[model samples]
Target: MALPSRASGGRPSARATDTALTLVVTAVVVAWTVVAMQYEDEPLSSTLVGWALIGVGCGALHFRRRHPVAVAVVTLAVSTVYYPLSAYDGPLMVTFALALYTASAEGRFTAAVALGVITLLAVGFGEAHQTGGNRQIDDTSLFMLAGWLISLVAIGRAQRTRTAYLHEVEQRALAAEREQEARARESATEERLRIARELHDVLGHSISLINVQSSAALHKLGKKPEPSAALTTAEEALEAVKATSKDALRELRATLGVLRQADEAAPTAPTSGLDRLDELVERARSTGIEVRTRTEGTPRPLPPPLDLAAYRIVQESLTNVTRHAQAQSALVTIAFTDADIRVRIDDDGRGSADEQAVGSGIRGMAERAKAFGGELTAENTADGFRVSARLPLTTIGGTQG
Candidate 1:
């Protein structure tokens, strides 16, 4: 299996700096060893042995980041031995510095505290023994130990701060990504609903017109001596379909265009309703289907959505009869009562009484009716198919039934 890739958009890995740091550390150790060797008042062999042990301790520095605690322990052990053998000086101090850095980076607080106390005690004990309890201890060892402890604490604090900062950044980035996804999904759902509404509005009217006009054209073709007038009526129906299609397309583009531009003007055209039903029927009659309309009860004003729902139920029922019922005549009935508005469309045609699964047209009409706190039912009778829808007349704010 392949290795997993590293995360994007952060500092380079610690491994990236390994080679440079190792070379720099090696150079520093070698330079300090050479200076220490120059001041030695001993045989070359003894001095060479001492420098070799220091070199080994410095070489261990390369592994500090990968295993900081282990490197610190090894370096401390080597330094303890070197200090007693040779007087505490440059090479030993360099090893101690490396150990201090390792301990700060990786060792626990308890380990650092223990190391600090032991180092100070060792220095004090060595000083006391050399002076035979008569001379004052030098301040240099205390200062060195103090500096090493401070460096360890500073490195640990810096590491903690860096970790907290990185965690905060990651959380903010994750939240931003989730917010963007939610907005995108909401926008998509709105666009889909808008398109559905527009299609229902535009096509519903035109299809109703085509059904009425086509039946008229067929009837007129059978009675007239010449077929030209019948042909003209058919042509007019087709033209109306084309015109309605174009209008629907225009409205769809308008709504979707607003969504595409972040700073576009708000939409202007509101949804259509039942007041336009006369023009809808006239357009159908122009196409040749014979459409008869009847209205009963008081013509009380209704909410926009319920009105639109009532109009659509009639419209879809007529369109279905024309398309699949093989019907020449259709009837539309509207009744307004105290509590609800009722709509019924009936047609006398072959195959109208057959029961089949509901198609998208019927489903769309049902959805419109149900959206307004209403219900719809379609059934076949002895003579033809009948569609009835009941919508509550009561107004409910912000509800689109």
Candidate 2:
């Protein structure tokens, strides 16, 4: 957007052409108007003076945009003196017209209009001077002069209007492009969050359940010498393993189904946000996990994305507890404030986590928190592992509905 390369046609810039064309036309008009003196029809002194004045007038047209009003006035004055002195019979509207247009288009409307009026008077004086002694101003001459001046001013104003309109249209196009890009980025982020939530829930829950089952089976075999108890424990562990694996597969399918063609319906089951957190707790309870959930401030509704992120953080942390912390009890605390919300998970067990070093679950939770301008921290304490997060209400706020 910054670099001005070219027009859409991939051609060289047209500004150069415009400048060249303007100067060329100005040169031609000046030459044609003064050709009478050049053809030896006027006195040598008058012709030389006329040439000098014409040069002064036409040469200033090149820098019109820079000092439009000033240059235009100077050129108009010079041309008026030259036109009458040389008694050149030609339309004296070339340089003045160009200068007036440039001045008005560059936002000097008053000066340009005043210049136009003065130029008309100058032309009238030149015409009267052409008629030897007594000359009465004719209506046709005055009307023609007025018409030319008005047309030039109107054209200049119209040019200004067209430029302003083009600029406005360009600004609107840029704004729309930025809006579209923002929407695209948001859609991509939402899709990523959806996939991450599904995977974190599926893998965290299944792996934790599998780890618990295996730990139970291992515990039962070594602690007891009875074959009947060991067999029952092994069968229970296998059943849990089978159920967890199947659930993981089903959830994976459901999550990926959204990527299919729109004609084919994906699963219509509601996504698990904070509303389904109770069901999550019950599932943990089924795995012999004792969870204590507490709330410290008044709870307000959350937007779906944030609610899902919050729920997934809790779910992943609890899953970590079930997987690694061989703790009998775990605590989850949710604190809400007018401007912010804090979530904390603590488990009192041997603290070595399942995937302790940069686990996918932890990374997903961190990503979710970061997406909403929040932060998450996890570390081992004296008692067990702790995962704490803080999210801003202003950034992630909306009603549940």
Candidate 3:
């Protein structure tokens, strides 16, 4: 059979180790054979044939790792014939034992077992038929030999099983690493989207109001160029613009602090939450859109993420009212209960019913609500457009009672 590329030359260190081992086996076998012959009066031709068989048997082991079954068979055949024909019975069975071990370690257990059985039977039968004054193979010798072969096979099988188990563990570790990397990438994407939503809510509301006030100021000043009246209107519009711009810049800076590296300073300004709902309402009212806000039930402190999500949902909803629903007035109702908080915004404007389905502002609000295990619904009501959200209240753990 053809050898795999890995078995032939994958590891240089393994090749070197195997070469040294083969040399050692060859030396031990040759030395034992020479010593045994010193006591036996064997003929020159018989000794020469024994030496040739020893050379072939030991040399075949060089490719044992690559072709374990073939080597095991060759060595077994050589050893079986050598004991019967050679006068000097040296340690020729050692080479066959090593080959059997290699076969078992290489995952050729069935072949190794078959070769071992054949070797035992052939050697036993040959010893039974011999009549010369040679060293006899007794029952104890056969039992000892069987014990040695079984031990080698057991040890080799254990090594094979250990190697397989280690390989499976490494594969499991690699799979876990890949899953962790995928989760990390998903988290990064969600963070980017969150930052984008924050920027939009912060900047969009202020800029839209600024544009409306500026346009109104210019129109009033142009229609009636009376210095007394136009200057006063211009002054009020500019003041509103200045205040809105400053708030926008502060919030923008705070939101962007999340993008800074770990070593850099974070923005110290407190995050906007329910405490700043009045400020948000005032800003929306500045654009001549009457914003009425009311609270129901008792007010309580909320977890930071839940509070932030609640505030953003309201802010984005009001911003949408100013930009899309040309309504003159809107009502925001916040209701706090023992288990959850609800916020509802209703505007009496002729806005498109499909706006809530397609608008990014509405989508961002829904995402925020979902992140907190809450729910949001935006739909056209009999009066106009309505956006409502209900967020559960709990401790730091994201569970709702």
Q: Which candidate should be chosen as best, given lDDT against the real structure?
A: 3
- Assess candidate 3 and give its TM-score to the true structure: 0.81
- What number of clashing residue pairs does each candidate have, in the order they appear? 12, 0, 0
Q: Pick the candidate with the highest TM-score.
A: 3
- Error (Å) of candidate 3 at residue 256 is 3.1
Clashing residue pairs, candidate 3?
none
Residue 173 lDDT in candidate 2: 100
Q: Model 1, 1-401: lDDT tens per residue?
A: 11122445885655555556666766876787667657766656666666776777777777766666666677777777765565325554565565565555453445655666676787777677874556344678577767766777568646645655676787899999999999889867755774676466456545555455555556666787456776776676567766655545554564455446667776665544567677556554555468888999989777665766676677667667766777777888888889888999887866643432244277777767777677888888787778889888774422343
- Cα deviation of 275 in candidate 1 (Å)? 3.2
Candidate 3 regions exceeding 4 Å error are: 1-67, 82-95, 136-144, 221-224, 264-266, 356-358, 394-401
- Which segments of model 1 are wrong by more than 4 Å? 1-12, 43-46, 91-114, 117-144, 189-193, 200-224, 227-270, 284-318, 325-359, 362-401
Model 2 bad stretches (over 4 Å): 1-15, 30-40, 87-92, 123-137, 218-236, 261-264, 268-320, 329-401
Report the poorest 10 consecutive residues by lDDT, candidate 2. Answer: 1-10
lDDT of each: 0.65, 0.74, 0.83
TM-score of every prediction relative to native = 0.69, 0.67, 0.81
